[model samples]
Target: MGRGGPREIVQLTGDRDAISSVTFLADGKTLASGGGGMVWLWDVSYLVKPLSFLCAQVGRSFTQEEWERYVPEGPAYRKIC
Candidate 1:
């Protein structure tokens, strides 16, 4: 997420072409970015993994349990503990 400053915690770069529109789906985990010739739907729920920053730097993918543990909910984000 991008804060008030120039610093951005998450940098989502998928569209190779110029982006025209960006919108978040009702679930808030799905992001739709449109531009150029095609539209891209990104599932941001994957970012909820614990040690996300470290994992990203090492090019690692988190298992479902990891995301659930860190997100306080579960992989589905229902969050009932």
Candidate 2:
């Protein structure tokens, strides 16, 4: 047997005090992550270039109120207030 390097290509970190989980959207064009007691949507269509950083950085520093603003209806999929 031969040893191999890790195959992972992406990493995301955010709101250390409140993050719960991170998930990908159905189409893979976006990312949905939970943090600060809420979920957020990040555009990932530009993963081939620098824009991917924006998606990864999107939820890294959200406050509770800011999370609520982005995911106003709470952690569920429904978009309501």
Candidate 3:
């Protein structure tokens, strides 16, 4: 049903108000969120495989130099994709 990993079902923008509530449907994959006097639904079944989702969005993994900037004292960068 999906490529796997976590995939963003939708991106909400232009709403100045904060979210008021949220509920997950019985199926577990459907989610409902309310805000700004409106309700939005999302399908979250793709979250089972987060790596695939991230790889698909970025098309490439982080480079050593870039990773070092965030984890300067951590282990060497390893490509995830």
Candidate 4:
């Protein structure tokens, strides 16, 4: 998208083999990918506000030291909640 050919907004990992197909369901919030004789369904609605969703699930933001250790070049830490 945009000037680039395509962009990656999020990554869904843990597949054991190469993904052969992908499709969005009629609801548009669900994504399906198939490979390795299996099909996986993903709830993609959270992509709209992934940070908020993650913060809710994790229940806490990274500490300043943790942020600095993980994202040395990132901007100053801010509470995601």
Which ranges in model 1 have alpha carbons more than 4 Å from their true place? 1-6, 47-81
Error of 2 at 69 (Å): 38
Task: Judging by lDDT against the true structure, name the best candidate.
Answer: 4
16-74 per-residue lDDT for model 4 (tens digits): 47679999998888999998788899989886676577578779987778768754554
**Candidate order (lDDT):** 4, 3, 1, 2
Q: 1-81 in candidate 1: lDDT tens per residue?
A: 333445434678775567889898888778888887788888787555545544665475545666565544323543232
lDDT of 4 at 81: 71
- The predicted structure with the larger TM-score, 1 or 2, is 1
lDDT of 2 by residue, 1-81 (tens): 223544444565556567677777888778888867688777866664433343366735455666567544335333122
TM-score of every prediction relative to native: 0.45, 0.40, 0.44, 0.51
Question: What range of 10 consecutive residues in model 2 has the weakest lDDT sum?
Answer: 72-81
lDDT-wise, the better of 1 and 3 is 3
The superposed Cα distance between candidate 3 and the true structure at residue 39, in angstroms, equals 1.6
On lDDT, who's better, 3 or 4? 4
- Residues 6-81, candidate 3: write the lDDT tens digits: 6554575534375788898888877788887788787776665644565677799867777677445445667878
List candidate 3 segments past 4 Å from native: 1-18, 26-29, 35-37, 43-47, 68-77
